[model samples]
Target: MSEDLPALMSYLDGLPEPHIVFDMDYRIVSANTAYLREFAQGQDVRGQTCYEVSHRFQAPCDQAGESCPRARALVSGQRERVLHLHHTPCGEAYVNIELAPLKDRRGRIRYFIEKMESLAHHHGAPGEQGMVGRAPAFRATLEMALRVAPSAASVLLLGESGTGKELMAKAIHEASPRASAPFVVVECASLSETLFESELFGHEKGAFTGATSARVGLAESANGGTLFLDEVGDIPMSMQVKLLRLLETGTFRRVGSSDLRHTDVRVIAATHRPLREMIAQQQFRVDLYHRLSTFPIRLPPLRERREDIPLLADTLLARVAPLRHLSIAPAGQHRLMSHPFSGNIRELRNVMERAALFCDGDVIELSHIEQALAADAWESGAPTALAVPMVSAPVPALPGHRQAQADAALWEAAQAHRGSRAELAASLGMSERSLYRKLKALKR
Candidate 1:
């Protein structure tokens, strides 16, 4: 440490947010009181590498496939900011990292000062509830959310159906300055054209044939908070102009009333359909689309982040069967990873719940997974092959006679198999644990 390093640390301690000073090699030179209090829990982190202390990684963040703000700042000779999932005393949380390269009198970068601000509403790993996954695709969406949260910018969430758009909207609201206020949702798809205006803007008594009493609209109900418009693409075209007016003027009037009402609510909109195509076809208004998409974020589909299936399954299983403490076996997990979830996280949750119902034991097995998927297809009035596309061969039928025959064939194939167990398990449409168990039974 330099002689003036103590003076620098004294300056950092006077500041508010968590701050750390580290050398170009990523070794921590000193930490501010805020850093020790929030991140280190009062423990000193002077000698350890920043990556090791923050992420528990052996190498730097970029080496471990994450964006490194320090590296970017070093190149640009300016401050750089990034979102990262850091290990904290509470758990793994999404944090905003701001790194600024400090140059010496000779114009050479000597040290770096990093600041961290945790996103309280988000988690990097699966917990009992809330958001999960640490994949790159998921992180990108979260980073955008964090960047726009502090401000009152209108956000638009774009993704396929069942990709958890509503959840993402709520997360943004919770992370924003409006965390204490209401977070209301308007299901645009379900509202009829006649009811759309009345629901969005309150209706006075005797406004329509069925208007028995005065009711508050969602916009007024979400005053000083957030109003999430789910499936904004499905909103009736006839009512698009009204919505546009409300967003533009922040003023509305109840049905059958002349008085205009004002609200200070922030708006968040989500949709699965492409707004640009809708605009081209004249199905949606161009002005409204621009108003709602000030900061658009696209959520990733499940297939893009397959490694999160197990964590999501475990979390959903706990919610679906809380008392049973059920779990998915390795083979069951492989089966889940094999299918392309067109419905995304929503479909995955349904599969986990159905599999829980099929399995009577504590652990959900491969057979249970197959039966649940088949049942889902049958209920949807589609054949298994057509409904859920499998990446490899089709899953075997679960009838007793057919299962026995399938086992015999699997045993023969296992005997001739030469690849790794993981490859063999994937090829057989089963887990390695299941294969090992079956082989041991045959030997016995």
Candidate 2:
């Protein structure tokens, strides 16, 4: 048995991907050189449990509420695959895990082989740009995107407005095999029927009023890469059949020319509207929907994955003010997390940008965030639903008069509220700890 371990290690060492062999008890029996360099930083991990080495958890992944591949392999006695956020040397990363069960002559499960492929294009933590999330919902959606990236199938991204559908589409494109080719975007909602066709499939010289010269369409431009149809639901009914034909046949004719052209491109379509409703209402075609939805991935809204708020806020702040080196105070972070963020990531970006502009110093406080949100709501013509009642009492003349008045108003609101501290804090557009800080500030 001991000699067999060396042979197994030698065999795995030749593989490029990270591989580790662990006993049924989950103890790391051996790690290949690739695994050592990628995950363990050349450290010996012979006796450590997989859970400890990968997640720093005392319990197994299944017990910790994660879908454990090893447990599933044990039951099925076959290979199992799962997407996992593993703690790597650099930081947390999304890795595709493939686990295969190893059995002895007696058909008894002895050890398991786990192979890990890191998703370099996506991040489990906040990055300078690109996808940043660790919430289970986001991870599930990301897994679907990654799984379908290598295939030639079409992808339909369904999500609410401002939920980062375009960003998700870009991620799929960058991860796909056609990454080296051009990625062309066609805004379906903004174009007329004639323009849509002309933009999508090109036009010959003098095809229409503006066709003075031969124009290459987006389909030709994205011949070897990806064509992203944003707001795809808005594509006119008259044009659906043409788009459907192009998708089904992989060929299309220019607006004026009778000659057909071919394109080797992957289609990624996104829409915020209800497509099923459109189909029922006869606004969208059923066949086109089927053609575009070879693999549909729903991007979880910001509210569904509130756990990612802090990470997203920090990342957005960095992008909003890369030169200022600004930071959000704990209270400001709490206030941000408590808000509804109705516009999702785009709205969050606006809030951070506004807050950065409002901050006179390096640190953004709760007051600055509140002002920014209020300004946004006002500029958008939204009612002042969160306006706290003014303090009727007079304030004596004092230094920092504006600060004193603001503190007085906050103190009055906190005292007048007749609900739980958490409820009051939320109603006041802040966190409980921030509420406590305001009261403490009043005392001083």
* Candidate 2 lowest-lDDT run of ten: 389-398
User: Model 1 segments beyond 4 Å from truth?
Assistant: 1-8, 14-16, 105-107, 385-444
**Cα error, candidate 2, residue 407 (Å):** 6.3
Compared with the true structure, the alpha-carbon lDDT of candidate 1 equals 0.84
Measured by TM-score, the strongest candidate is 2
**lDDT string, candidate 1, 82-132, tens digits:** 998899999888889999888887788889999998777677766777788
The lowest-lDDT stretch of 10 consecutive residues in candidate 1 is 384-393
In model 1, what are the clashing residue pairs, if there are any?
Answer: none
Clashing pairs for predicted structure model 2, backbone only: none
lDDT of 1 at 223: 94
TM-score, candidate 2, is 0.86
TM-score of each: 0.84, 0.86
Tell me the tens digit of each residue's lDDT in model 2 across 233-285.
99988899999988888799998999989988899999999999999999999
